[model samples]
Target chain A: MSVFVTVGTTKFDNLINTVTKYSAIKAFQDLGYNRLVLQTGAGKIQKELDQLEELDKFTVEHYDFKPSITEDIESASLVISHAGAGSILETLGAKKPLLVVINEDLMGNHQLELAYQLYRDQHLYYCECSTFVETLKSSDFTKLKPFPDKKPKLFVDYLDNLLGFK
Target chain B: MDSELGVIAVLIAVVVCLVPIFSIYFSVNRTCKTKNPNVTSTKRTKPASVMIIAGSGGHTKEILSLVSSLGSHYSPRFYVIANTDKMSQQKIEALEAEKIKISNKMEYSIHTIPRSREVRQSWLTTVLSTAYATLYSFPLVFRLKPEVILCNGPGTCIPLCMAGLVLKIFGRDLKIVYAESICRVETLSLSGKILYYVADSLLVQWPSLHQKYPGSTYIGRLV
Candidate 1:
């Protein structure tokens, strides 16, 4: 199975570093993963990723930002991303299995709320930046619930009625 | 004496015939050259024309879902997006395709304005770009003359909302609805901060934000 790692539009240096660290890549290798795609947006971790690219065992590819990030997300067996709302919603919207890692350095502290809520709902796995490798190694993916497709009909009706449409 | 009275009767008949003609001309001219263009009633009659602001990714996704939820009441929509946002255009087209499969009657237009800011870009450039975007949006808003404008929290929506505010100042009645993104459960984003004051109605996806911003209405998670 392929693994897709993305940090979304903003910079998340710590999350990128922790995920692309030597030990974390080794953990994926131990799980017999053949392909790994890393999308590090504005994060300064290319040198570390380049060094890992030298190894011949598995393919490692990285990009800053691309319009085709959705295509990559679709092809991957699992998506490991920073807890940005855009990334989280897109992953879940596409019905992809996801594991969101929170970057504690965000100023507003909303990412933690989103991650915890999704985790509590059993929609996807959530973890902190430091515990990347540990969670990957111990988590059981087969038991996770499929992402529920939520239709916003109620909220839509509320707004429409408020606008005096009905 | 009888000849003079006949002439007098003929003159009075001519005056009576010209009176109604002159009054019709004056009334038609008044309506045709009225100063205010928005003479139509603001109340919803047929489907209200809607203008929705769509940013990249989550903002666009949420706005699209809201557009779908509008059902058949809001039609001939104008989806204003950033100039570089091809993803949003693609998503809209995909939705349009889906709509056509179900029913072939969705009428919408897409307009692209300059981006207000890029991620991690300098604030100096952001100010200039935002000014340009706001200027560009003015004509689009005036031409569309949408009865309502809808947006979630995104920097691109700021200029469009500013345009709506200006229209409101000009006595054009337009409803501006700003719904905070569901991702923002705790606090408002920068765009949310600006629109919270200006929007006709402000909605928050989380209750905590509703408590924090007392002016905002909460309707649970929208996405």
Candidate 2:
């Protein structure tokens, strides 16, 4: 199994640090995971990523950005991402098992609203930066419900109506 | 002679009453045609151009979803993004690439403007950057002459929307549509609040938002 961690085009050092640590890597390894791919935005977690390569417990690839992380998301067994709506929508759209980590240090509390909503809806699992490890240890991703196919046509109709399109 | 004068007065009264009715019809028709740029008689004509303010992260995603849902109704779309935002550029490039692969037409372009502020940047610096970004948008807005400008809740959208408004003030027929971000279940975001006044139409994803923002129209989630 493989895990993909993405911070979504912005720096979230805390989430990167938590996942790149030896303990987190080892925990995944013990659970039969062998590969990890991280798209680490602008954060300075490259030094730690390089050191992890030496351990040889699993293969890890890190990049500042990938034009299309969808390919990475598809190949991974699990996806760990920042609690951004785009990332969540992509993950859920793909019907992949997802674990979202919200950075509490950001300016507004908006991300919390989305994270909690999805969690309550059973669409995905969410953990704050502080409780990431504990939640990771306890959660069973198989039990999560698949995201429903949200009909996008309604939005189109609304726009057409608003625009007075025939 | 008396009967002739009475008949003439009745004709004048009828014309006066019909004048208001005709004016009302013309006004409604004019607003509908101009306010809705996509109301062309046929779809075979070139699709209307839309200028979208694609902010980083979530904002970019929501806009992408909106474009996809629009399908071929609007075309030659332009995305305005922050100058330093390589991630958004990459995401858009990826989306465009996939779209081209699916269909051979290329109808979108991306423009980068200076960011108003970086994360954790000082307020003094933010003001300077914002002014620069707003000034930079003036030429781009004139160049594109987009029929419609679409934005969600993001600080980056403010200057671009203002530029569109400036164009409107100059007697251009353009519409600015602001969709409050889906994440705002209870209240509007900072950008949403500012845009509420300038945006020609404000749409909220959650119905509850209509009570707070009386003019806001409730639409289901775009994503």
Candidate 3:
């Protein structure tokens, strides 16, 4: 199986760089992930990825972006993503083991709040770029609780009652 | 004596303008307080007209998911998106197509308004653009006359909600519901902060937000 790493629509060079390191590749291999698929948005890491691919330790694939990463996310055994709510929810919706890497440079601490809340709920593991490797090595992906299912019915019923449809 | 009379004339004009403005404000507030949303009115045979505001990116995703959950009675959906956002239209169309497959009936229209602000835009320009958008929303809101407006956190929603308020002032029972984006855990977004005072029903996904803003209801994770 492969490990999918996505930075969503924004440029996140730190995440792309950290995961491309030999240690990260070895860690993926340790987890039995023989292929690494990287969705590197606007990060010029293809050259480094190619160089690592030549080592023949495991397969390395890289792309800039796609209209939808759902297919890739579904196929992968594990997903490493930026702390954007959209990507986090999509990965969680796909019911995959997700390791969210926060882009601390971005303004606002809401991303941290979302990641922390989910982490507290045992739904996902989150880390900064500095602790990427350690978190990967130490965290138990199997123990992660599946994110609660989307209950649109609650909202519909609420609206219907509020609007006097019920 | 002539200058004093001119000053008096100007004061009268100012008071005349201020009277209507203050009256409208109090009238809107009274309507907001007195309208009991919990009281179920007599059921109608016809579908209710709804206006859905789709913001960019995650806002659009969350709003659409909520829309998909709605029953057929809340139909003839009117969608408003920013002209600059190219992605939300396609997503809306896709969702509508999916709805048609299930029900074989589709009633929705999409409209675009000028974006109030772009990323990194100057505050001065943002003010002017927002005012322009607010003016643009009045006609759209008047034309649609939607009974209900559903919006999540987006800069675009503020102007539309204002328009809905205007309709309310004109004796129309337009209901505006604003759902704070789920990304906001502790604090509300800029749009959410503004809509807190205006929307008929303000919803927050996180309990902390609900506790912080007594006006907002704590609805569990919507998207």
In model 3, how large is the Cα lDDT of residue B9? Answer: 33
Worst 10 residues of 2 chain B by lDDT: B2-11
Off by over 4 Å in 1: A1-79, A90-98, A103-113, A116-125, A137-149, B1-45, B120-128, B169-173
Top candidate by TM-score: 3
Error of 2 at A107 (Å): 7.4
Best by the lDDT measure: 3
CAPRI quality band, candidate 1: acceptable
Clashing pairs in 1: none
CA lDDT, candidate 1, residue B47: 69
Chain A TM-scores, one per candidate? 0.87, 0.90, 0.93
Candidate 1's error at B187, in angstroms? 0.8
Clashes of 2: 0
Evaluated on CA atoms against the true complex, candidate 3 attains a DockQ of 0.47
lDDT of 1 by residue, B1-223 (tens): 3323332332343234335533554455333232443334444456678898998877898888877666666777888889999989999988777766656786887899988667655555555666667667766776787778999856778767766765665566678999887877777877777777889888887777899999998866677
- Residue A104, candidate 3: C-alpha displacement in angstroms: 2.4
Residue A149's C-alpha lDDT in candidate 2?
Answer: 75
Q: Model 3 interface RMSD, in angstroms?
A: 2.7
Candidate 2 docking band: acceptable
- Say what the interface RMSD of candidate 1 is: 4.1
TM-score of 2: 0.70
Clashing residue pairs in candidate 2, if any?
none
**Interface RMSD for each of the candidates:** 4.1, 3.6, 2.7
